[model samples]
Target: MTIAETAAGVEQRRRLVTAIPGPASQALMDRKAAAVAGGVGTTLPVFAVRAGGGIVVDADGNHLIDLGSGIAVTTVGNSAPRVVAAVQAQVADFTHTCFMITPYESYVAVAEALNRLTPGDHAKRTALFNSGAEAVENAVKIARSFTGRPAVVVFDHAYHGRTNLTMAMTAKNMPYKNGFGPFAPEVYRAPLSYPFRDGGLDGAEAARRAIELISVQVGATNLAAMVIEPIQGEGGFVEPAPGFLSTLAAWCRESGVVFVADEVQTGFARTGDLFACEHEGVVPDLIATAKGIAGGLPLSAVTGRAEIMDAPHVGGLGGTYGGNPLACVAALAAIETIEADGLVERARQIEQRMKSRLEDLARSDPRIGDVRGRGAMLAVELVVPGTTQPDAVLTRAVAAAAHRAGVIVLTCGTDGNVLRFLPPLSISDELIDDALDVLAETFRTTTVTS
Candidate 1:
């Protein structure tokens, strides 16, 4: 199969003729407020009319620099030629024929790709789902079925999903879990090796602490799975200290606990490596992946050891829309694009550029507490000058200022003090530098009020 070329007609520069929202976007926002649910929040009220190659053109023709990559779902860029062509062909042929009932080649093709790409060379199996949350929930189900255990372990500052069980696994309270309970049961929370706030404990020591807590509180035998994000996403792009993941994986292996890597955010080429767990040479028993797995299509999967994945009954897994043919084709095209375009290397280049710029900015700004993340997925944690106290106010102010200046940035973390940068791997260096300039100016001006 041949790779598709970049889309035409969309310029790759930031341009703002009208205000940020302009009249058209404001009108859309007004319509959205009245028609859409109030809970569906938007990072920017500007309605996008066209987007490609690091620029999202709003209704009023304002071209905004897209740094968020639609929350890391567009690592291959929106309107990726390969993905668009694949989707177009698939839609023309067939959209869906539930994999559970009438399986198609594209579905098996995507599964084969995932089984080959994910960490480890072990005999593997895969199950498709429609979202990250569905993949995660199914992973948990598989783990429990294989281990015959009831308890599942999670960590603080983790963002799994909004599903009942995942929401229970998640640590944050507001937005994700507020008034959404009661959540699932038997999901235990453990301490993560957050180097920034671990008070001097290194990765190994932090792992020891977490293992002790799990052994004492949840008991190793009762644990069905130990799920964690190699690099925590929404929880501020927190990359665990060195040796943390390896140590934890080691203990889980020795204790027969299924170690599941929640790579929903860190999977694909979003991280420098195809999988973040590859950074530490830790191969998880099960890996939940989505967001960037299928360009921008709604698809997810649980790839794991053959025995574990096959533990559930024959008809126990699957959904009505899981592994939809169109999404499968999109995923195949996306994986091909990643390989043909050398996006893995591109992600590393993005990291180098982003880190260099953000680190330089941090040198002059004390509020830029820490710069952490891997590959194209990076972030800066905001804190009070000379102290570790989170400065969420400053973070919001800077993000808002960037939005006003025609840049799309996203803030995350339990404290809402992290400004994450998940630019598409296909984005150009020039656009990245342009967005950084806006960020620098925003920080310089907004820090005073913050």
Candidate 2:
């Protein structure tokens, strides 16, 4: 199907009738400043009226190429037909009955699907939640209950969530965690296998160092769980070196520490594989998933080994809207779309396209320090010429340029020096090439000096 036909039937081509964030969006921004809280930030002020395929139609009729995919949530596109139909049917039947109280069939179905789809062939169990943070918090609880331990281990550039405990687990400070402190205690941070910045340590050496630190500082016996993103998301799409994840999983197995894979941004065919952990054949003891789980609906889940998942008390694990009927149906539809549409393979195609273009760009731009990631989830880390010093300024400039030129790009990384690309799998090759053209021009015009 064509890109436009896929995304809500809007014309597939980018059309800029006015400047980015034209009059209508600017007026909305004014209203937002008056009504909305300041803490909640926006990447671009352009108000989205509609989105589908790979374009977000803004208030003033600007069709901007969507490379962010609403932060990797819309793997099947913003308005996948099946998800829309399922949500409509569920909404017509009922909106909320509080699954914790009444329960539902769709919820159970979602759990079953998650169990089957998540890595590993072993019998598994799943618990539903409203957000990635909630899933993570509950996963920690399950690990602690099962192991009788208090400490939770996370990596240096990890981003669990924004909740109290998850805030502690997350690594970044300014936006996500600054001043949000007195965060949950006993959350230990370990070194990650960041090849770009790890002083030339290979995957094995980095894993060895992390293991050594955890052994000395936190002691595996005291650790309840060691949570990591199979492919670190907000931390610049930093895919750990080869063997790092498997080695970590093996160590966790030996130590009885629950290996929790936070696949919030990398799951549901976004990372080529069904889950990022599958790339290394590492099956997590517990997997926290969200983002791409329910098309655009709010749903998250913790799927893991049966015994560990059952460790929580009968009543200790649920939320009022944990598995809202509407969200559950949406999740089921989204999963079906992924499987039926061959989105997993589509993600691989997107990766090859994006990596090829970015690598071509890198050959001429010294600031393009490294190009990394997998499937549709990819990134380029900017650096000072001839040095590994992060260049956040250049990153911001390029992102802003992309935005001005009617393309939506997102910036990430602990140092904020990386530009991430997460286009929808349903997006057409034509649209992707167009977005890359914008990126190429942005790089050409934006001065990057040594």
Candidate 3:
């Protein structure tokens, strides 16, 4: 057997034996269309059979480079050895005892790990959940209970989730909140510090603008929480100007509003720091995390100050599968992999390499308007060649071209004009180079028609 077939690894290179979707994947897509909900969309129609390291093997044996990391879920790489081993052992013993019913050790262990890892050294407690949306929902509930207030504030371009209350908090409209509204009440939207678009306002000044709006409309006396993604994820990896987060967080602390950091995408080792809030030395009163938490398993958490987290009544929190044993064990293993492998620094290395390449692309390509993000989570905003107008059509065309060429890239932003890259830290440098080469070529080929 070759090195790829043996214990060391799966094939690390991208190889396209057939077209992008091929026959096998197309067949699955056909079946899915007939059975699955039409409301659920697919980014790349190709179905993955096996995935590891930086490669995702589709049904037709095409090994594609993974730049999205399952939308920032598989941070330790797919089928990470430790996660697999732990899941296997846990499954043999038990899958779900329902932590609310007959609590399990893995569940407690996972909670302890979250409380220790999340930003802030304050006395903290954690409540587990199954997805990022659940964590955010619970965080809001906890904040409301603690403050005995009814109003909440969120920033522009923020994406919390799809549930009733979160949809009201999310800023985007079309795909995430078009027809699904008639959303929850008392959620207010504030301005965000978009440095690229904010002219040259410094962080503190920009934050002042948002604070003024919030105080005027949703006064601190009535506000329960202020929820925001440290680096806005699905809305575009919009890293706020320097000091923006710190200024806002301080205001919340003094005003008694629970500052909630939705690090669902920027948590773990994806953004250089274990938590993106650490980048600004901002300590949130509550943090909702999910993506990249369990090496692909579905596990999320709300970690926060003990008094705030414990404000809800005895039975006010928890779900039937909130802290499922299998997910908890997978989380423990994933956390160990992150610390032992030094993935935090690895993310910084990836940021340096990717930012260099993307910046070089921007220098030569006029359509590339901005290069932003940190660590493995970087993005480029595409604009009309001469102006700041969003070139969403060109963005979509280029992404399709990359998908065809065996590189998986995801697009985001309210205008759908930003291309974000979230590569697994386990990915090799060579693999990243190859993916960038494909991206460069895709831009070149698509720019001709644009």
What C-alpha lDDT, on a 0 to 100 scale, does residue 141 get in candidate 1?
Answer: 99
Q: What is the lDDT of residue 170 in candidate 3?
A: 94
What's each prediction's TM-score? 0.98, 0.98, 0.98
Per-residue accuracy of model 1 over 1-450 as CA lDDT, tens digit each: 111223435788888999878999999999999999999999998998888888888999998888998899999989899999999998998887788888899999998999999999999999999999999999999999999999999999999999999999999998999999998999999999987788888899999999999999999999999999999999889999999999999999999999999999999999899999999899999999999999889999999999999999989999999999989999999999999999999999999999999999999998998999999999999998888889888889899999999999999999999999999887888889989999999988985434
lDDT of candidate 3 at residue 233, scale 0 to 100: 95
Q: Write the per-residue lDDT of candidate 3 for residues 34-150, one digit (tens) a residue.
A: 999999899998999889888888999999989999999999999999999999999999887788888878888988898898888889999999999999999999999999999
The alpha-carbon root-mean-square deviation between model 1 and the true structure, to one decimal in Å, is 2.4
Identify the runs in model 3 with alpha carbons over 4 angstroms from their true place. 1-9, 448-450
Candidate 2 whole-model C-alpha lDDT, 0 to 1:
0.92
Best by the TM-score measure: 2
Position 369, candidate 1: lDDT? 89
TM-score for candidate 2, please give it: 0.98
State the C-alpha lDDT per candidate: 0.92, 0.92, 0.92
lDDT of 2 by residue, 216-279 (tens): 9999989999999988988889989998998999999999999999999999999899999999
